[model samples]
Target: MLISNIEVIPGKRITDHLGLVQGSTVRAKHAGKDLMAGLKNIFGGELQGYTELLQESRQEAVDRMIVQAQAIGANAIINVRFSTSAIAAGASEILAYGTAVRLNDR
Candidate 1:
């Protein structure tokens, strides 16, 4: 299914609105990675571990969102968005949401 951050996809028309679709995943930080991140913090460098984790989470969430859209018979998802939040002391949740729709060719 097609997904876009824009409210509308150029050259495509929204033929049907299938309401809101969303997917989320919760992940915990690894102790070893956290330690490495802490060390990097001193030098103000990128935390590769967390970066990888978030990237994976984002993809997972987006995949789930696509599943939901497919279930609803949607051909595309518009106004896609992602959100991150701390679910617990060591866990974080990533959410993907969008409006499911049936698209018509131009």
Candidate 2:
């Protein structure tokens, strides 16, 4: 399925709006990674561990969102967006959402 951050797809017409589709995952920080991150913080460098975790979680959320879209018979997803919220001291939730739609070339 095609996914885009834009509200509308150029050269394509949305034939049907299947409503909102969303998926989310909550992840907690690993102790070892957190320790490493704390050390890196002193030097003000990138936190690779957290970055990787977020990337993986984001992809998972997107994948699940696609599954939801497919269940609704959507050919594509438009206005795709992501959001995150802190779930706990060391855990966070990642969410992917979009409008499920049937699209046709215009």
- Please provide, for model 1 over 1-106, each residue's C-alpha lDDT reduced to its tens digit, 9 standing for 90 to 100: 8889999899988889999999999999999999998899899978889999999989999999999999989999999989999979989999999999999998
Q: Which stretches of candidate 1 lie over 4 Å from their true place?
A: none
Model 2 lDDT tens row, 1-106 = 9999899999999999999999999999999999999899899978989999999999999999999999989999999989999979999999999999999999
Q: Give each model's whole-structure lDDT.
A: 0.93, 0.95
Clashes of each: 0, 0
Highest-scoring model, TM-score? 2
Q: List the residue pairs that clash in candidate 1.
A: none
Q: Estimate each model's TM-score.
A: 0.95, 0.95
Report the backbone clash tally of model 2: 0
Runs in model 2 deviating more than 4 A are: none
RMSD of each: 0.9, 0.8
